[model samples]
Target: MSERDDEEREFDLKWADGAEQKEPSARARMLAARWKENPPGPVPFRADPEHVGSRRRSSWVSTAVVLGCVAAVIVLLGYINFRAPY
Candidate 1:
């Protein structure tokens, strides 16, 4: 608003060369892409048959096999008994 204030403002802008004196940061980067890292390598492992789920499946299979054999034996005996009179 006064002549002295305008002079001080012009003096401040006179130091604009100071802004260009500094260099940009070397480590600064732009437009970086994001990435999700995959596992380092293939796993050297196999599924264990004794795992709980595997054990249950194996138990059912064994149970079914045993029941089938018992049924077959029972039927064989009954047929033999029926034919003994012949």
Candidate 2:
């Protein structure tokens, strides 16, 4: 929720001092009010371009390392199969 929305929200409401803490009903009412005021939706997130680019580069390097290891295993198995003594 944004700052303006926060201001409009009614929270920690008190009917009387030392009242029973039946907060479930109050929470639902507050949620209903906020829903009517501002419907729920996904919050937009924007990452810094430089940070994203750096992460992408690191991911690519890791992928290449994994593929290289897989390729080495396959080559070793092929050589072993060809030279195995029955």
Q: In candidate 2, what residue range of length 10 has the lowest lDDT sum?
A: 9-18
Candidate 2: which stretches are off by over 4 Å?
1-44
- Give the winner by lDDT: 2
| TM-score, predicted candidate 1 vs. hidden true structure | 0.40
The sequence of per-residue lDDT tens digits that candidate 2 reaches over residues 15-73 is 34346664558889999999999999976598867789999999999999999999999
lDDT minimum window of 10 residues, candidate 1: 28-37
Residue pairs that clash (backbone atoms under 3 angstroms), model 2: none
- Stretches off by above 4 angstroms in model 1 are 1-50
- Candidate 2: give its CA RMSD in angstroms: 16.8
TM-score per candidate, chains pooled: 0.40, 0.46
